[model samples]
Target chain A: MRIITAEQISAAVAELCIRANRELPEDIVSAMNRAAADEPWPVAKNTLEVLCRNIAAAEEMELPVCQDTGMACVFVRLGQDVHIEGDFRAAVDEGVRRGYELGYLRKSVVADPLRRINTGDNTPAVITLELVPGEKLELTVLPKGFGSENMSRLAMLKPADGVEGVKRFVVDAVRKAASNPCPPVVVGVGIGGTFDKAAALAKHALLRPIDCPNQDEFYARLEEDMLREINSLGIGPQGFGGHTTALGVNIETMPTHVAGLPVAVNISCHVTRRASMEL
Target chain B: MEYRLKTPVNREELNRLRAGDMVYLSGEVYTARDAAHKRMTECLDRGELLPFEIRDSAIYYVGPTPEPPGRVIGSAGPTTSGRMDAYSPRLLDLGQKLMIGKGLRSREVIDAMVRNGAVYLAAMGGAGALMSACIKSARVICWEDLGCEAVRLLEVEDMPLTVAIDSLGGNIYESGPAAYLESLKGGK
Candidate 1:
């Protein structure tokens, strides 16, 4: 068995939070570059160019690409052979609190939705733990901003709705989102499973490298078709109008009940940030 | 069209602006977003003076990160303007002239802009680091407990913005896409 101390876990997570905010993943950065180069509309092209500058400036300034440093979403892949000392959740929260403070990232989390008071420290990260077979413990800190998150949608379609219905729902959601989600956006579509699981699958799908297609040929084709359709909407970069409304489309699916055809669309801005480490 | 605009931009200057035009704004701009907007509106409702003057002011819809050592401000970028729609029309009627943010405005907010001779500008969203470069200085005005959401006064030099909505009711969110779609149809 591999033993990981909470102090170690907390320290790693803190660095991840700082890293995720200050630096964007290379995959996301390249996707934006490709979109900018390929955009047709003049306004859209200019918008993409400016966005690239932002990315570059962020690296130089050691600041977050966006001011909405977002809620600390921690994803942990824990191995069955691993034993963690101390309270695991508390360790994660401590990391977020210190990371936001040390990194000068915004503490955007609120203690209660209705109460609307700032939590002071960006504590109590949204944690997702999955148990796997290996002895290595992997942690990914996804800083998800609300601009794109608020634009996401879900549908519980009838079995008859099928693929076409899913496509329509996804396109309509993007159309409705328009300039709000900060195009060129990254879309994650979750099909199958129950309602909540489908939503989780959609978000999880975003962690997949944008350049890598789903291993399944069928899902890969669906992603391409949806990307084409979404770009056809002329929403472009920043929705100022162009051919690159979405940088990529990713779909995740799993087996579901006979009655269920659940779908969730998780939209991410160009600044989609996640940093991972293994302990 | 591109223009160099300095606040407090008056009704005449706003009328010259049109949707889709790029502008570089330089002057003292006030910052506030969801939380601070709520607080400001509540203060007005109680017949209390706001912490800063609103008339002819350019209010930025942003919640910036904490500044690092020696820097005047942290990464400061616009938040969604839609969230403040409910409170904006009242501020517009109070003679607030310019609003800097990203995203579509409510129809009611647009109508108020047209009525009040105001304009909406879109600062490049997610360009916080770059945006902060334009801001020379920042100081909290009120609601410090709100942290990032506290209202601040920022002195910016040549802050780039797109005229998303002009005083005459032109809206880039509507026109930009429709024009692109029309050209696509025209091509075929």
Candidate 2:
């Protein structure tokens, strides 16, 4: 069995938290560049240019790309053969604590929803673990900001509603979001499974590279169709009005109960920050 | 078109502004997010003095990241402004004339702006690193215990913004997209 220490996991999470905040992923950068090139509105083009400059400044100055450094979301893939030493959950939280403090990233978490006291350390990261067949442990850190998170939506439709219903819900959600989530957003769609599973799948869909297509031919085509319809809304960059409302659309699906069809749309802004490492 | 604006912008100046106009704001501005706004409105309700002046001043809805060494401030950008909708009308009634942030505001907020001759400007959302370059200095004015949610006094130079709502209730959030969608149809 491959052994991994809690300390190693903590240190890796810390580094990832800092790195993911400052750097724009290459796929996102490329997608934005393409959108800027194709955008028809001068105002929208200008907005994209400013976003590019922001990315550069963040990288050069070693500052966060956005002030809302976001909630720490860590996804872990552990091989069945690997055994971890020490408290796993505690290590993840420790990493978040150190990362937020050391990186000078914003501590955005509140202790409770209604009471509203700052957590100060941005701790207790949202972690998802999956077991795979290997000796390696893989970790991905995504700092998700709330502006887009607030705009995400989920709907449970009758089985008869099908693909058309899903499309309508997604398009309506994006329209309702308008400029709130930051336009030129990446849309992660999860279809099928149970209600909660579909929501999780939608978020997981966002982790895929922007240009990558879904493995399923049907879902890939749905993604493309959704992308076209969303851009047609003319929300543009920052909702100034243009042809590039969305940079990409990603869809993930699973088998669902015969009674219901569930779908979730998790919107992410242009600076879709995520980082991964294997050990 | 771009205009260089100084704080405590007069009624005449605000009236002249319209949705979609680009602006570069300078001089003194204040920072307050959801928590601070709630506190301020509560103080107003209690007939208590505000921590800072509200008349003709611009408030930025932002809760910035902590400053690193040798920097006056950290990455600072606008938070979603819709969250502040509940408190904005009251603040506008108290003579808060300008707001800088991102996203849509409620009908009541827009009505308050039209009634009070205030304006709303949007800094590019998520453009924190670039936006920080324009902020010359920042220091907390109150609620330091709230951490980043504290009210701050900031001096900015040429802070870029686009007019999202004007004194007359012209809203770019609605009109910009509508116009573009129409143009798309026409082009086709």
Candidate 3:
């Protein structure tokens, strides 16, 4: 078994936190450029121009893309063929704690949902671990903002709704959201899993690169259709008038029980901040 | 589509602006968001003088990052406006004339804007780095313990904003979408 030292995890986590906070990802940059070029609405195009400029400024200033530095979510894929030399969970938390402090990220993680007490250092990252069949471990850090995170929704629709029902629900969710979630958004739709699994699938869909394909043709078509429908809503950039409402609609699905049709729509704004590393 | 607004503005000046009009804001604007708004409103209920004056001044609903060295502020952008809607009408009634934020205002807040002759503006959300460049100066004026949520005073220049809700009940948030949607149906 290949044992990875705890020290390595610590250093990587610290750097990941700082880098993720300071730099906008390249895939997102390319996607935004493409979206701007393709947007038909003048106002929405102008909004994308501001967004591109913001990305450049953030990089030059070495600041985050948005002031809402967001909640720390770490997804770890641990390999069964490998051994960790130290307490894995503690190592991860230590990375998050050190990274947050060193990065000067906002301490947005609150102690209680209702009381809203800030946990000074953005610690206790919402960690998800899956054991896989490799010698390498992968970590993805997502800094999810409250504006879009608050608008995430999940539902178990009857099988009758099928794909058409899914379309309606996703459109309605965006409509109800209106300007609240920060428009010119990226939408991740997860379908066909169990209720909880669907939600996770939708979130994982966000980790996919903006230009990547869904592999399944039907799902890819659904994504295109959803994008067309959502943008047609005229929510536009920043919810003011424009042609582009959503940058992309991504759908990730898993085979599920025959009796139930579960779906979830997770909306992310232009500031979709995430980064990953393998060690 | 552009007008220069002066602080401590009254009914007449505000009435001249409407939703979707571009406006250049000058003069003093204070910053507040979820925590600061609650505290300020509670203090108002207690009949205490607010840390800053509300009459005719604009309050930006934002929580900004700590400034990096040599910068006035960092990654300053508008948070969702609905979160502050509950406290805004009360403050508008207390003589606040302008609110700068992202997203739509609640009906009650818009109504308060009409009755009190206040205007609402939308800054580009997620455009923080660009937004920071407009802030010529920033200093904490109150609630420092709140960290980024602290009430700060900002001096800005050429900060471009669009009127989203004006004193005349013209809401761009509603109208912009409707106009485009109608055009879409008209196939224009």
Candidate 4:
């Protein structure tokens, strides 16, 4: 069995925290460039220009692109054949504490939601673990902001509602969100799973590149259709009115119960902050 | 569609502005959403002094992120105005001039805007960093205990904002999107 040291995890997390804040992933940057090419609204096109420029400037200056650096959300895939040298959660938290402090990321996470006091370190990151068959551990870091995260929605539609219901839910979500999720948004649609499972899948869908196609042809088509319907709302970038309402729609689906057709829409802003590592 | 404001705002005069618009911002407005509105109306019942003089002054519903170093502020973006619906009408009774923010305003806030000759301006949401650049300075006038929620006196210059709801009851969030969609459909 391969043994992964705690020090290595800590170092990787520290590096990812700074890198993710300063760098816009190349895939996301390329996708924004493509969106700018197709965008028809002058104001939205201008906004996309600013977004692209911000991405470039952020990299050049080693500064965060957006002020709300977001809460650290780490996805870990641990291998059954590998052993962690020490306490995994503590090691992960320590890494996050160090990253937020050193990276100058916002300490947005409050100890209590109602009282609304900051935790100071942004520690105890939203960590999710999955056991896999391989010997290597895979980790993905997503710094998720509240504005777009607050806009996420889940629905448990009847089996009779069918694809039409799914499409309607997505369209309605985009319409209601209008200008709020920072237009030229990316809509991650998760279909066909239980409640929590659908939400998780929706978030997982965002990890994919904006321009990439879902392997399932039918689902890929659904994504395209939703993209068209959403942009047709004319919410445009920053909701000032234009053709660039959403950059893309990504759908991820799995098998579900005979009675339920669960759908979740996880919205992400143009910033699209995330990173991945393997150890 | 062009309606003159009782409290006129000349375009040239508005050109030289900053991130936080401070023009003695008059010309009819409504109030809506969240924590501030709730307390404003509660104070109205007791006839207490509001944090700022609400008469002829616009109230923007926003919750911004904490500022970073060598920077004036963080993601100072607008929140949904609908959440403030329950508390808006009371302030409008005192002649609140304008309500600024994003999302759909509640029917009550809209009614107050129309009745009180108020306007609702839509500031770009999620354009916080861009918006912050326009703010010259921000000082807490009241509610210091609210932290980021304090009533801040923001000095702004030439802040770009669209008139979403004018005194004439022109609803942009509703009509703007529909109009653009129609033009697109008609192949304009």
Candidate 5:
């Protein structure tokens, strides 16, 4: 069995948080370059240009891409053979606290949804775990800003809605989001499974690289179609006007009960930030 | 029309602006978002003075990242303005003339801006690192306990913005997309 220390995990998590906030992934940069180069609307083009500049500035100046540094979403893929040496949850929260402080990131979490008291340190990260067949532990930290998070939606459709209904719902979600979630957004969609499972799947779908399509031929076509339709809405870069509303559409699905067709759409802005490390 | 606004912008200056006008602002502004607005409104309810003057001043709906060493402020960008829709009308009633934010505002907030001869402008959303370069100085003025959500007094120079909603009730959020769609229909 591979043994890992809590301190090592925490330190790694802390660095991941800081690095993810300051750097734009390469695929995202390429997508932005394409959008900025080909956008037809003058205002939309300008907005895309500014977004590109922001990406560069974040790295050059060692500053975060957006002020809303967001809730730290740490995804862990652990091998069944690995054993952690200490209190894993506390170590993760400590890492989040230190990273938010050291990186000068915004602490956006509230202690309770209703109480509205600031957490101050941005602790208790939303951690997701999946078991894989290996001796290595893989970690991915995604800083999810609420601006786009607030626009995410899920609906349990009747089996009758089928694929067309899923497309309609996803498109409508993006349309209703408009300028709010920040256009040139990434749309992550999860179909099938139970209600909650679909939402989680939709969110994880965003972790896929922007240019990569689902391996399934049918789903890949659906992704391409949905992306085209979203851009056609003319929401543009910052919702000013044009044809570059979304950078990419990612879909992930699983088998579900025959009675229900649960679909979830999770929107992410141009500031889509994630970083990964393995140990 | 492209214009430069020096803050404490008067109603006359704002009156000349229209939705879709590109603007560069150079002057002082205060920053606030959902929590700060709630606090300010509650203080208003108790007849308590706010941390900053409301009349003729601009409030940016932003909660900035903490400044690192050698920086004036961290990535400072506009948050979604629609979240502030509940308290904006009240601030507008007090003669708050300018608001800097991103995204849509509610119908009532637009009506309130129209009533008060106010204007709402948008700094590009998620372009925080680029936007922070425009802020020359930033210092927390109140609610220090709120961390990034604290009210900050900022001095900005040549901060680029677009008038999303104007005093006369023109709204770019609704109109910009509509115009683009219409142009597409016209085969542009």
Candidate 6:
């Protein structure tokens, strides 16, 4: 069995947290550039330009792209043959604490949803683990800001509601979100499965690269159709108004109970910061 | 047209602005997010004096990252404004003239702005690194225990913003998108 130490995990998590916050991933950069070129309104175009410049400045100055350094969402895909050498959860939280403190990134976590006391170190990261086939442990860090997170929605539609219902719900969510979640946002739609699974799938859909299409022909077309419709809303960049309301619509689905048509829409801002490492 | 606005912007200056006007704001402003606003309102309820003056001052809805060594501040940007809708009308009634944030405000908030001759401005969302360059100085003035959510006094220079909602109730969030959608319908 391949053995991985908690120290190694902690160090890697810290580095990834800092790096992900500062750098705009290449795909996102290219997508924004394309959006800027396609955007028609002058105000929207200027907004996109400023967003691009912000990304560039963040990289050049080694600063975070957005002040909300975000809740550290650590997703781990562990192979069956690997054994972890120490306390896993505590090590991950420690990594986040060190990362936020050392990188000068914001510590945005609170101890409770209602009590609202700052956790100070941005600890107790939202960590998700899944078992995979090989010896490699893959880690992906997605720093999710609450602006968009607050805008996410889920609805358990009856089986009769079908595709049109899903379409309408997704469109309405984006329309209501307007500039709140920071358009041109990424729309992650999860269909089928149970309620919680649908929500999780919707979030996971956001982890896909902006340009990648779903492998399924049906879902791929739905994504395309949704993207076209959302942009047609003219929410534009920063909601100043134009044609590029969303950078992309990504859909992930699974088989669900015959009676249920569960769906969730998780919106992500233009920054959409995420990074991955394999060990 | 771009404007260079100083702090304690009078009602006359605010009334002259309209939705969609670009602005480069300079001078002192205060920072508060959800928690701080709750506390400030509660303090106000108890007849306690706020740490900073509210009259004619601009309040930015932001909780900035901690400053790194040698930098005046860390990445600073506007937070979602909708969350502050509950407390904004009351604050606006209490003589807060300008608010810097991103996103939509409620009808009551807009009505309060119209009634009070206040204005709402939007900084570019997700453009924190660039925005921080405009802030020349920042220091926590109260609620230090709240960390980033503390009330801060900031001196900004040429901080770019767009007039999202004006004193006259001209809301760019509604009108801008409607106009663009209408233009598209006109085949522009």
RMSD vs true structure, all candidates: 0.8, 0.8, 1.7, 4.8, 0.9, 0.8
lDDT of 6 by residue, A174-264 (tens): 9999999988899999999999999999999989997999999999999999998998888888888898899999999999998899999
Model 6: per-residue lDDT, tens digit, B1-188?
67779997988888899999998999999999999999999999999988888988899999988888888988998999999999999999999999999999999999999999999999999999999999999999999999989999999999999999999999898899999989977984
Better of 5 and 6 by DockQ: 6
Per-residue lDDT tens digits for candidate 1, residues B44-98, read 9999998999999999999999999989999998898999999999999998999
Deviation of model 5 at A81, angstroms? 0.5
Candidate 5: tens digits of C-alpha lDDT, residues B71-143: 9999998999999999999999998989999998899999999999999999989989989999999999999
TM-score head-to-head 1 vs 4, winner: 1
**List of clashing residue pairs for candidate 5:** none
**Candidate 4 docking classification:** acceptable
Over 4 Å off, model 1: none
Candidate 5's DockQ: 0.85
Clashing pairs in 6: none
Report DockQ per prediction, comma-separated.
0.86, 0.87, 0.74, 0.27, 0.85, 0.89
Question: Where does candidate 4 stray beyond 4 Å?
Answer: A1-11, A50-64, A113-120, B1-48, B58-65, B141-147
TM-score of 1: 0.99
How many backbone clashes can be found in candidate 5? 0
User: Least accurate stretch of 10 residues (summed lDDT) in model 4 chain B?
Assistant: B14-23
Q: Which stretches of candidate 3 lie over 4 Å from their true place?
A: B185-188
Tens-digit per-residue lDDT, A192-228, candidate 3: 8788899988888888877886888988888899888
Better structure of 1 and 3 per TM-score: 1
Where does candidate 2 stray beyond 4 Å?
Answer: none
User: Which 10-residue span in candidate 5 chain A carries the lowest summed lDDT?
Assistant: A234-243
For every model in order, the fraction of real contacts preserved is: 0.78, 0.85, 0.71, 0.23, 0.82, 0.85
Q: Write the residue-wise lDDT of candidate 5 on A1-279 in tens digits.
A: 999989988999999999999998999999999999998888788889889988998899899999999999999999989999999899889889999999999999999999988988998799999999978989999999999999999999999998899999999999999999988899999998998999999999989998999999999999999999998998888888788999999999999998999999999999998999998
Query: What TM-scores do the predictions have?
Result: 0.99, 0.99, 0.96, 0.83, 0.99, 0.99
lDDT of each candidate versus the true structure: 0.93, 0.93, 0.84, 0.72, 0.93, 0.92
